[model samples]
Target: MAWNEPGNNDKDPWKKKDDKNQGPPDLDDLLKDIGNKFGGIFGGKSSKGGSKKGASNVGIAIALIVGILVYAFSGFYTIKEAEKGIVLRFGQYDGTVEPGLRWKWTFAERIIPVDMQTTRDLPASGFMLTKDENVVRVEMQIQYRVVDARDYIFSVTNADDSLSQSLDSALRFVIGDSRMDDILTSGREKVRQDVWKELDDIIAPYNLGLIVVDVNFKDARPPEEVKDAFDDAISAQEDEVRFLREAEAYARGIEPRARGRVKRMEQEAIAYKQQTVLDAEGEVAKFNKLLPEYLAAPEVTRQRMYLSTMESVYANTSKVMVDVEGGNNMMYLPLDKMMQNQSSGQRTLPESQSRANQSINTQSTAPDLSGRADRFNEGRN
Candidate 1:
């Protein structure tokens, strides 16, 4: 039977010895009972002295367990995508942790999150002296990112500040070495490139754990006192550059045409030379054929040559005026004009007009050369 079942008054476990008082259990006795139950785990005997000591030790152990659980849970951390975790073990450099939920020894290790993928911008601007001893205000910006998290944390006291200082130093150095005109005008790009290169060279030995993505020359200008003058100078330089570019473009466009024309002229000259050579050779061959005739009859050959020359000359001339030495009459003809008129307007002419035109053409063509024929005949005789 159970101790508290039915009506078994003496066997009831809940029945207190002091039931007449009907009060809460004694605090000391309740603690002793709980202690005795836990005491069994540490092999403590169920006695007054052992129970009290066991209770104290059990309470301390519970507290320690709770503290350990809290510490373990606290060590867990999340690294972001852009960040890298640098793990230091017992205040000494250890290894790195990737992006995820990670745990470390609570009081012994440390994690410093350095954002490696995020590009950070640093700007440097101030009045700087140029190589020409002119003071100018220059502004420059640099984009950088942490490449080595461990180096970033340990190599310098503050990586970002150190990088900033390096950039400023590099900018000033380059500016001091450059001319004011260069910084303010056409050489701005060169200044930017020089600063970038100098910054790289400066930081190369420091191991700043930074990589410069790019350097930008934001602005550069002369002092306010000389602002207008410098603006005018810069404008002039820009106009000069524009003119130079236009000239180059024009040259590029014109060069091909000029070359084409030169080639065409060369080809024409070659064709002309070939034609002249061929014509000269044909004339030489004709003269060779005439050599035999000239030797056979000198006077007849001379007369024929003169007539041939006259015919060739007359063929090119559009107008002719002939004056006979013995006669007082002069003959004039405008054959080219008449032929042009006939071709331009092809009007039907009367029969008599057409016949006159035919007769005139015949007379002009044959030229009534009886006098020349007689002269040639006499020479032949």
Candidate 2:
């Protein structure tokens, strides 16, 4: 038989091996499979065991690389300026970490970034009794900054939400104890400050390291249905105060002037009285000074004063008259003609002056010379 025939014992070209004659695996071929297992055990690159070992090693290397990368990523973290990073090791707080790039243990640690510079707002969420015993709805906003990161993260479960709820409770407590009228008007500012204080007190007991900022009143008013009435009442009160102030201002302006006018009138009255008294005193003094002079020479002064008064009375008149019982009566008593006759020496003198000039003793009117003028008239006729 030829060697290439069915009796040929040479290795097949596809085998590519020198002491190996296995094809693959066969079902129900127990000895063949068992013999092939021994060959593959000793086989090099073409063997299945070597391929499996290499594949497993390659897969293990890929897993190791992936694990190392994860570890590096766990160590890397960024902390912004406004943020604080809190690390908890297996649910236990370690300490506080500030901003910037940082590296920490990766696997068993936890990180929470709390914003340190953010402003939080908390609203008043309940009915509060004001100083006036009214239930007023006052919404307050609180601004806060995170000061302690470790406390913020570990002190409370949810720090921001917890503080918000606590703020409402605190505000209600403060306002419920206050009267409504005071809250609406004067106590609002006090309520704000008190709310903040109470919030601090409530939070401090829990070791919730929170810095309370300002708490301010948002809207302070009565309930909606009574808002208008309150407004009207407030406006009426305002008008009353305004009118009172205006009246006070008017009084302040007029009082001084009124007082000044009264003072001026009083001064004028005093001056008038003083002048009247002075004039009366002057008249009395003058009368008192002249009384003695008039008393010293009563008849002479009276006669002289009477002559002066007659001259003054007759100065404007153009007539004069004199008559005696036993004396001659003139025919024409013209003032100009009598003066001319006296000057021309054609007038006769009266017996009174003739008796006084001749130094003769004259008989008085009481000596009964009754027929003298008749006898003289008859002799002249």
Candidate 3:
């Protein structure tokens, strides 16, 4: 039967044989027995007085060892190459740490790592009034990096946020001082430069510990309400610039050719003038050389000059006239006309025989030809 069952008469299975009516041992006695067994295993005296004290000392030592391990492990940390750690002791600034493995008191110090080498971007965009009282939407991008870890962490409440506000303020200030046409077109670079300068000035006194690497004027445009009109205006402006450049190129190309033509004409005129002057000088020199000869023999020179002049005149003439000394008739020979007639299918005598025949006819017609020839010679002398 089961122990403590009605039929078993509440018999205790673990009781001694001499015990009677000692139903179930007392709770305090059982606890004491368990404690004595544990104390004996751990080298503690099983006597009631010394066992409690020995157990308490063992527990205190274990607690102390655990606390030491937790504190040691919690202090170790690592910093990245691009980061700088800001240490604070008892909520007050301590010092900074470089990148590497480092340790600090677990609950006494705190480290805040700031990324010093990372380039952060702050964008500012809004519709702003131009100097000409026009609204323009301008978008700008500011690239920056943290220069001082301590200043970045403590000098400002929020460095990035403060920088963003400064950027907006600077952009607006620059845009407000600029004309709309410049902002939308050729003045973008100037606007970008102005914004960068103004932003730096605004943050200089605040010591935000940020270095602005570059400022990009991302986009600038008129509002959507007049987008098409503005686009047309911009296109027209572009066309004007293109036309001006093309015209300048054309002028540059044509100027050289024009100058060359002018130079060539000037050279040609110089050559013509020199030739004329040289010819006149040669004529004067020849006349001077002939003056003495003419003075030495005036009549002979006069006759010779007259004959020479007549020879030169007749050499270029196609008609010839001969005056007989004592006859009233003059003979004419149209050689050029005769030659044209002959080529047009008319028969003509040989040139030499024709001249001979003309001479014979003239001699036969003239009377006293020798006396007339003597008279012409006497008249010339």
Q: Evaluated with lDDT, which candidate comes out highest?
A: 3
For candidate 1, the 10 contiguous residues with the lowest summed lDDT are 359-368
Winner by TM-score: 3
Please report, in order, the local distance difference test score of every candidate based on alpha carbons. 0.79, 0.69, 0.80
Question: Candidate 2 has which clashing residue pairs, if any?
Answer: 130-178, 130-179, 130-180, 131-179, 131-180, 132-179, 132-180, 132-181, 133-180
**Candidate 1 lDDT, 1-381, residue by residue in tens:** 765455545554545875743334666666667767766666766676555665675686688789989998998999998888988888898999889999989889999898988888999999999999999999888899889888888888988898888888999999999988878776889999999999999889879899999998888888899999988988998899999999999999999999999999999999989976886687567556765666567677667766765665455334545667858765666777878876654465566555555434434433224345446667988
List where candidate 3 sits over 4 angstroms from the true fold.
1-57, 296-381
Compute the lDDT of residue 336 as modeled in candidate 2.
88
Each model's TM-score, in the order given?
A: 0.65, 0.55, 0.68
How many clashing residue pairs, candidate 3? 0
lDDT of 2 by residue, 118-171 (tens): 877666566667545787888888888888877777777988888888898888
Q: Superposing all C-alpha atoms, what RMSD in Å does each candidate have to the true structure?
A: 9.1, 21.9, 14.0
Q: Please, what are the lDDT tens digits per residue for candidate 3 over residues 297-380?
A: 655655666666556545433454466796976666777787686565323546655554543443342234333444656797
Best to worst by lDDT, what's the order?
A: 3, 1, 2
Q: What is the lDDT of residue 331 in candidate 1?
A: 62
